[model samples]
Target: MDQERIASAITRVRETLAEHAAEMRYRDSEAIATIEAGLRVKVNGPHGASIVTDMPNGVGGEGSAPSPGWILRSAVASCVATLIAMRAAEEGVDLPGLEVMVDSESDDRGLLGIGAVPAGPLSMRVIVRAQGTSDDARAREIIAWGKAHCPVCDAVERAVPVQLTIELPGS
Candidate 1:
């Protein structure tokens, strides 16, 4: 119930992270994931391309695209949705429709023309929608809680340290 105590706790945790940052590594792993019986993914890509299984309805994608990054982004949105839903439920709020729209900007200056953004997704925008029962204050509170709980949102907002290791096939 004390804001000062909560703030102190958070500060202590962050201090711990800073103390152990040098020992931290961005550990990576992969697993074979199947979407439906038809779509599968060869998660560990020793080769340049990952094999895709049967194509979806009409996209001809074999229901597979680049993994890891997309999966992380989807997880971000899912985290937001889940946290918001949980908060709303706890507060006895009813929402008819809820959605999160996320997009990223990439730079293609050299590859494209002038004023092109960048070569990677520069930013993401999430628009949350909710039709609730006359509880706008609770809705806003839920949204705030969602933002506060999302790991991806916290990482981006706080600029977490990242260590990069690129392993070429022969390297």
Candidate 2:
């Protein structure tokens, strides 16, 4: 294991987070609501986009909108790819033409109105394809670093904490 390389990767990610924190706060400056079955987000502003996401049933839309779950999966894969590239570069591992596909599965037993079998984002599998010098070794390293660095993967693996507030009509 390359300790110095790993340290460098961590430093770069920290710096990136610090650099983007303010911009994120500025851009993500709205709030929304949703029920327990899923999450409905209403980002107010001309540039904001309103999104309704559910577990498996799908994201509702007016006229041919993509499913939210699919979007989420895409986001996960994209994040993994980005993190892998960044970590691999820092680790002195050459990576080229990298692409990742994320797949998720959920059982519909409970959704069929049966007993409460508990449904959620069950499992996510990632398929990575890339070519470069030291491709195999870099692929291995990227697989490891991707699981460690991706925020979406972290949210899925580590279970991020979320707090919800609802406004009452009379209040």
Candidate 3:
């Protein structure tokens, strides 16, 4: 990790925020996905990274890659881990090892239109394991701060309005 570069970037971000007040620049991210094979999708991001998503064989898919729910969990876990590490670094905490685990349970009956259950996960859990921290109080503080500061964690905890539009050919 390039500490100097990270410090410089953080400084630049602070300066930008200070200059812009509440009118900060917006960062936009987009992903494109194309249907691969049965219940599989190939998603391509702007960073030249691609991932294959598929459903389990029970759900009429070959179970090639991870499901969308798993991907969401992975995103939450990875974002929390990164935010914790970055915050620890900023606070001069020497963390040798950090692990984050995220889990959620969903009722698929709603998706399958079999029952009146919710289509999303019922609940989510996030667990963090950190090494090289002696003070349990400080470690708890850091973990709490990380949870509050992580954007993904915030999004997951709150309900954000989403507008969906569908376009079909010849329609």
Candidate 4:
């Protein structure tokens, strides 16, 4: 990991936000998606990037690409992994091997409309594997700090307001 670069970047952002108080309120990203084919969608990410998402054969999709739920889980796992690396860098700790895994439990009855259960995941588990020399306590501290500071982790764990507007061709 590039500790110096991460530390420098964090310092720059902190200083910038401190000076520009108005700019400190919002730090956000966006993704847009449109239905492509049966149970398939084309998503546009930041900077003109793109990805395809499709449901499994059970859901009438061609199984061409990963499902959206899988994508969400992957994002959670990767985001936490990144947080760990950033934290390590900031703390000047060296971690040779780091692995993070995320799992979520949900009830299909919610989606199938067979029950009143929520469609969202009912629970989530995060597994982290890494070791840094300083001390076991220090390593735990870093990992906890990373997870606690992770934006995705926080979003999933807490409730955030979503403002959405849908436009139709003929209304």
Candidate 5:
């Protein structure tokens, strides 16, 4: 990891926030996906990155990539890990090995239309591990701070309103 670059980026963000308190609100970003084949989609990220998602063979898909639920869980884990690193850097703590694992129980009954279960994960668990000079108490404090400050963690823990609209070709 490039500690210098990470520190510089964090410093820049802090400076920007201090300078533009009222104008720092970020606009909504979006990820676009298009159907490729049966139960398969090609997702395009804001950057040049792209990924493919497909269902399991049992679900009548080719199982090319991971399912959406797995992707969501991975996103949560990655976000937490990044936030932890950033927080540690800000606090002058060296975390040479930081890892985050996110586990969730997914209920597919709603998707299958076999039951009335929720369409999302039933529950989630997050585990963070890192090696640092700070004591256990300070480590706990950092984890707590990350949980409270991480946007993805907050979104997962809270209820977010989602509005879906469908557009048909030629009206």
Candidate 6:
């Protein structure tokens, strides 16, 4: 979207969050993904939205969809792009050709249970390109601020706690 439209959307989002501060801040949400027998995973969200993920055929998967890691990369890239657009809009900078690329670096042996490597990506690189604007400095400022403010990026960078539970069929 153009600067004006983006600004309007950002304002709406901010207002909504502020107006529903309590509910928005502490909403109970969970991602549900189910796999029947193989590596294919189906994730369902509200409003009937869904996503399917799979590993490659070589790894005993259907290979019909993107892998889970691909989804993670997409989430990070898209979130950064959205925040950048919002910041640019706030500053009235037009970015008609904004683009973002996310590169996830992982060790194959990690997931394969080799050595002591981690199962997640060791590092990630984000490339942001802005076009249709000659304000290079302002564009850089927006990109920097937006990238810094991305929640997904922060989550990936920082350590977060996770709990595991095993459910049996009957008892």
lDDT against the true structure, each candidate: 0.63, 0.67, 0.83, 0.85, 0.83, 0.88
Model 5 quality (TM-score):
0.89
lDDT computed for candidate 4:
0.85
Give the Cα RMSD of candidate 3: 1.8
Error of 6 at 58 (Å): 2.5
Weakest lDDT window of 10 consecutive positions for candidate 3? 1-10
Residue range 1-171, candidate 3, lDDT tens digits: 654556567778879899988896576577888998889999998879898999999989999899988998998999988877766666666556788999998889977888789888889999999877877787778787887788887888899888798999997
State the displacement of the C-alpha of residue 34, model 3, in Å, after optimal TM-score superposition. 1.4
- In the range 1-171, model 2's lDDT, one tens digit per residue, is 454566587898789889898665443346443443334333333366565444323423332334555777887999998888777756667667778989988666644556776455578898888776566865787677876879888877886777777779997
Colliding residue pairs in candidate 1: 105-122, 106-118, 107-117, 107-118, 107-119, 108-118
Once model 2 is optimally superposed onto the true structure by TM-score, how far is the C-alpha of residue 162 displaced, in angstroms? 2.8
Q: Candidates 1 and 2: which is better by TM-score?
A: 2
TM-score of 4: 0.91
Per-prediction CA RMSD (Å): 8.8, 7.0, 1.8, 1.7, 1.9, 2.2
lDDT of 3 at 29: 74
Candidate 1: residue 46 lDDT (0-100)? 47
**Higher lDDT: candidate 1 or 5?**
5
**Per-residue alpha-carbon lDDT of model 6 for 18-68, expressed as tens digits?**
998877756445679999559989898887889899998887998889999
Alpha-carbon TM-score of each model against the true structure: 0.52, 0.63, 0.90, 0.91, 0.89, 0.87
Off by over 4 Å in 4: 131-134
Q: Could you give candidate 1's per-residue lDDT for residues 68-128 as a string of tens digits?
A: 4455566678888876766665555666688865555545462245575543457777778
Candidate 2 worst ten-residue window by lDDT: 56-65
TM-score of 3: 0.90
Structural RMSD, model 6: 2.2
